[model samples]
Target: MQFELQKALPVLERTPQVVESLLYGLPDEWIHNNEGGDTWTPFEIVAHLIHGEKTDWIPRAQVILGEGNKEFVPFDMKGHIKEGKGKTLSQLLDEFKILRKENLAQLQALGPTEEMLDLTGIHPSLGTVTLRHLLASWVVHDLTHIHQLSRVMAKQYSEAVGPWKQFMGVLGGKR
Candidate 1:
């Protein structure tokens, strides 16, 4: 799809709400509770999402908006997790919400399409990328993680034991 800020803005704006709903009232321990395998806990997912925004999305947006170097360095995901370790879920979500808002403002005030294309960033892995493409991928990235969160939540609810499982089954396997 030809992704643009106007096209992706709604999804971007709504993502925080979706994430908020998914995380509401979830026990702190639930963040650490993996799905009986190597699957990441909800907490790790949230942390990763926030990290993606800070390290990937925001910097890329800046590059696309002609505010940063064309040859940007890649961010380390593991380092992000360690740094975010002390933060609570609410704190991380709040930071993400603020960053999202800021990104929206930058997107709204973005210059002409030509100017956007003039900008670039070396993705460390992907090499040089046009600003437009990077912004487009940011939205795609959000949708990917949203779907992942949905799947994880589904697995958690479905595998829930005892009365919770019975109740969730009654609620169409969602709770």
Candidate 2:
């Protein structure tokens, strides 16, 4: 378990970078793809991530830091995506970037203590998870959507006819 946690930290550290890479150079139209009427575009995903960071993640982190037994609620990603419907891709990405940086700062400030690893709140889906698990999941969530955004970008590029399309194929890997 210790070895696994150590390995996961580097992935957590890469969340911001993953987000930047995932949303970089996305087209404006692609940001508002209400095509299927049931899917989130790249812009919506960024906004949802920002909302998660601000509402779900930070409060839980504070609770884990010995503040109180505050109940951590799950974020409403669908609602956030809807609320951010008209925002530009750049605007959403910038907000997500700022929120992610703040999360990283808070995580960095934790002392190396077992108390830091305590499981405080029970996630409705994930059940009881430690601070360490929550921290790790934060990055995993970022990475998961990073891949999703890249796929959206790739599909958009594939529909285009240019050298940029060829470049997109190489850039958008599932890794």
Candidate 3:
């Protein structure tokens, strides 16, 4: 698929609202509940999303646009726990909305061209990647987390869902 910034902007811009719509005002127990094992709670997911907004997408884009082949700083996948310490879900949501808006504006300001999209950078683990790959990943990352949040919330009713569990793929299906 082509990398059209105009097309990507709306989805990127709407992610925070989509998360809020899915999660806001839900009971604390429900929002904080995890499916056990290594699963994340909805609260932790939001925190991680916020950390990505602050540290990942736009910063990597800047490196691709400016530094050419410079290797990216490896992202801290587990850093959100410290970053989100002492904050409530509502606070994290509000902060994410603000940060996402600012990042989207910065992306627009960069005005990436086709050549810019083709420019490459070195990822610590993924080897060479392009701006096009980064931008597309940003959009997909939002969607993946949205689906994760939905699945986590759905698991809250795993047992309560009764025989309908067979039809409700989210409850029993592998992620």
Look at candidate 1 and tell me the lDDT of residue 20.
80
Question: What is the Cα root-mean-square deviation between model 2 and the actual structure?
Answer: 4.7
Better of 1 and 2 by TM-score: 1
Against the hidden reference, what TM-scores do the models get? 0.77, 0.72, 0.95
- Per-residue CA lDDT of candidate 3, range 1-175, in tens? 7768889888998999999999998999878899899889999999999899888998999988884456788999997897689998899999999999999889989999898899888899999999999999999999999999988999988999787888887887433
TM-score of candidate 3 on Cα atoms, chains taken together: 0.95
Model 2 agreement with the true structure over 1-175: per-residue lDDT tens digits: 4524457667766766677675567567766563355866777777777778778766787766665565567666576756476776677767776777777677667643566666566776777778777766776787787777766665655646465554554344332
Lowest summed-lDDT stretch of 10 residues in model 3?
Answer: 166-175
Clashes of 3: 0
Mind giving the per-residue lDDT tens digits that candidate 1 earns over 27-64?
86555676567677667777787777667776666665
Most TM-score-accurate candidate: 3
What's the lDDT for all of these models? Answer: 0.71, 0.67, 0.89
Clashes of each: 0, 0, 0
What lDDT does candidate 1 reach at residue 76?
Answer: 73
- Candidate 2 stretches with Cα past 4 Å from truth are 1-10, 34-37, 67-70, 82-86, 157-175
lDDT score for candidate 2 against the true structure? 0.67
lDDT rank order:
3, 1, 2
